[model samples]
Target: MDEECSAFIDRDGDFMEVMCCDYGFRSGASRMYQQENDGRIPKNAFQLGWDNFKSELRSLRQSIRFDDYSTISEANPPRTPMSRAAYSVGQAALDSLDAVDRALEAAQVLEPLRPRAVTLDGVTRDSESGSKLINNCAEIRSKLKQLKLSNKAMWDREHAREQSGRGVETPWLIKGVYLSLCLLLDFLYENRPIQRFWFLETVARMPYFSYISMLHLYESLGWWRAGAELRKIHFAEEWNELHHLQIMESLGGDQLWFDRFAAQHAAILYYWILLGLYVFSPRLAYNFSELIEYHAVDTYGEFVDANEELLKSLPPPLVAAVYYRSQDLYMFDSFQTSQPMQNPRRPSCKTLYDVFKNICDDEMEHVKTMKACQDETVSQDIITRREDGPRVGL
Candidate 1:
């Protein structure tokens, strides 16, 4: 249906480009930009100043979201992201997901199937047991179908738009790193979009981590006190990415041992490299991140277009349900610098399609922020309490 519609362009040009299913038109991007910069918390949140109270509350809330999914599960579910036939399909998909849980439970007794490194723990016996375990896995896999994205031709066409130069130029070193990462991903994740997204989210969190680390270090040394606000915003950005990582995990993206090992190690290496780059020249670091983020936007955009049907059939992961519909949405709005000061983003997460769509839009937010950081005029006030940080959106 989306293939038949022209790209929706906002007359105001403040919203992200949305592609609605029923209308064969674009939608969500406009809603995401309807943001407000109101710095007030619940009137009774705390007795202290709203700013200080919200800051502490956000940190405490982040910790709970990561460490206490138990509490989140107990919270009431949000409004469903889909309805009618799509909702029924999502429910069926969720029912089928039980198969995944059962398979994991069945594999638990097989030490070889576990993610931990194999050791000399009762390994010399039980050939029959090993064969039995293999047969069970095969049976489980046979009952399940791997999810796949369709419409590759559309993806290719949209991706080609990125290939056409849009006035984006990069330094040789930055370009080299970007190209090398692309090659690495193509080699590792060919034909595996879920795992590829898992790796990308893992690596994507590093730049914000590095940025926050440098900001904290500078402040600790009394070299910079101005970046306090920026730190808060960056921390929120990192927190957002963390939820994205967890959502991918829940989808079983980290099932392969090699993939887990490779992504983790690469993330560590990337962090240090970004840290060094940030220390040497902040502009260069921001520039590098901008290029990477822009590419991420394209990649996720392609994935969404390609996988529309399969994704719409799947229910969103629990983590996504919590993050998108959580009562505490300040963190979500903090990272979207491009939205208006009064309207906050409230993206739906009813199906896997909506989840990935929101993620793609979030990447665009990061791209806008990174680009703002690169601008000299924008950089001067990004860390300060000003309405004009950077004008960027979908």
Candidate 2:
């Protein structure tokens, strides 16, 4: 998922760089995948439309379809090919469905949790502060709803039954890409737990929501996947209501998949940090910080280059998705260096602050990995030049 929220928000530039790279690369991969399939398209959006397969289930021409894509606007502002395709698919699939409009699983508003603790670690806050956080959470969900709706429409418009466009022109590609982008944007909106467009009905219900959505989207687009899952889509407060792996891991559930087990498992850092908050009593702020640092440096660095080219070429819908991921990575890398493993107390416990550190650490590793991959490309170019030079000219 994300390394840390604040750091990610701050390193927007680094994040943007990574995102742009990821979208471009993924676009290439997706295009390759399409070519391999002889240009038809798939049901899900992986490497191209990885998360939800519906995006790729069209003609190859869909990639260039966003003619008037500028009309869309929501929190994230659709920016990748995947988003556009997804947007189109969402429209086709969602609209094609027989489900009632109110009953649709596409998006739903969640009731905000009134955190007894200012942070999840069991601390109290003044009424006004708590209310503010709750309101902010609501806002995040609302924005996400709009994003999802936009994508659904995008996909629908491009693939409209009446269109006779057989050529793979920009207009056609934009229509598909715009639709896919809309859906990708919607997925982000639904997947985010506390952010805009939080879908109440989604298994992205609690802490794992953000991670799972990210992982699924990454995999769907063939970018990368990581994180945890539960046995079934539905859940009850008491763990007994469902069937799960005997051990609390993802072994026996409804078969939740992960693209890269190691990278996605990186979420262990977040869980551990949360445990430190939820399960333990309040402690020194630095203690929490140290814990967060440990995870960031430890597991987060696992995926920086986990899926290089795939990550780089995300579609129009998912372009921003890659960007935010990179931006967060960049932000966390810097954030950890300064106040890492410190106390985040007004609440207490280094755990809270450290959680962010863990995330930052994860994103930074990605930054490192991406750079290494780029460097490798440069190095290869140099070697190629030397090889091409007059055969042992000396």
Candidate 3:
């Protein structure tokens, strides 16, 4: 669709000249504009040219939707020649869009087509996720089919300015990828392992590779939000209580153990955020990267970084179980952002990716508690020495 739009515009101007070229529409200099042979769609040229110009104009209109650019001339913004030229160009584009929308109404012959990536209603039936979620996922797919938009068409209007030599920030698709990943994360945590595995396989079966497209999108989320969302969502509906109960019983009836248990579980759930946003999300989606950054970057980033440092202070044995989990996360992040497929989720094992993250989170909580115990033991030893007359020989 986009290529067609571009083509119509590029060749539209010489429509009349080309239309009558072989029959002597113009004698010499004007013939340069007209091909002697029937080089293009003769009759369609005029309408196509006008339609192309109209598209350029519409692109400009969409851009001016941002209010920040308007106050430039009025607010004495950028007084520089380049800035002034850009402002002038933006205004001109807006005017052209409105004018062309009206004038070129008769010109356009080609209707816009859906973006190639928008197929499968954005996701497929998760028969791969197992029969349990297959129905549910199929329903979700049905819902999105009607909602698919041409907004993100590969010919996205966001890149319009770049065509005109403007250095504008073509909006990144990161937010879209982030949202898709979050959904994947959500489903993974919401469902059991079999269900999750099936869904990943379902994703792998899709026509387009969406991982790289989304990895760039998910990197900006808040550190804890995705993870926190994972924890809360599972609990939002009634929990299995079986897992909770089993863990409690294994702790030998200690209430303190229960407190620690719940905390650990809660923390463990947090890792799903990372898995969803970074590793498992699909790519045919968009969300505000700002929202993700707002949720993830500060506290969660700190937590992950700080905990890694704290983990270093632990005894090797205590750290050993969870240490590898953190390594997994590092590995996951590295793997997620690699080439063409950003966060290219591996087909077979990615189901465990979220699960491993969940485990890592719990392990970290355990480590934190162990560190506290170690500190308490040292403090107690000092107190005992003080009570014992503080090393009298010394």
Cα RMSD of all models vs. native, in order, equals: 17.8, 23.1, 28.6
**Each prediction's TM-score versus the true structure:** 0.60, 0.20, 0.18
lDDT of 1 by residue, 170-279 (tens): 79988898878877876556556676778888898999999999999999999998777677778878888887787676555665544666788899999999999999
lDDT of 1 at 155: 40
- Give a tens-digit lDDT track for model 2, residues 1-394: 1221212222334322111111111233332212344566455444444543432222111221221122222334547998778777755654443243324323553222121222312212445655454444344323322321233333343355226552122234334533453354345433221121111111112222332344455578886432111111112111210111111111111111221122134335444443444233212212232222222232222222332233233222222222223332322222111122232111111221222223334333333322322234423422343355422111
Candidate 3 lDDT at 254 equals 19
lDDT of each model, Cα atoms only?
Answer: 0.62, 0.28, 0.29
Where model 3 places Cα greater than 4 Å from the true spot, the runs are 1-76, 105-277, 280-394
Candidate 3 residues 1-394, lDDT tens each?
Answer: 0101011111123211001001111122222222344344354878977975665444333333333234224423555889779768877876765465445444764333222232122233444534433354334333222221121221233245336663222135655544565454342223122222222222221211222223334445543323222222122111212221222222111112212233344334433433454444322111222233222222222323324433222221111122222223322222111112222233211121222233334323322222322234423432333344322111
Among these predictions, the greatest lDDT belongs to: 1
Q: Between candidates 1 and 2, name the one with more favorable lDDT.
A: 1
The parts of candidate 1 lying over 4 Å away from their true place are 1-145, 149-159, 163-167, 376-394
**Which 10-residue window of candidate 1 scores lowest in summed lDDT?**
22-31
Q: Which ranges in model 2 have alpha carbons more than 4 Å from their true place? A: 1-127, 150-394
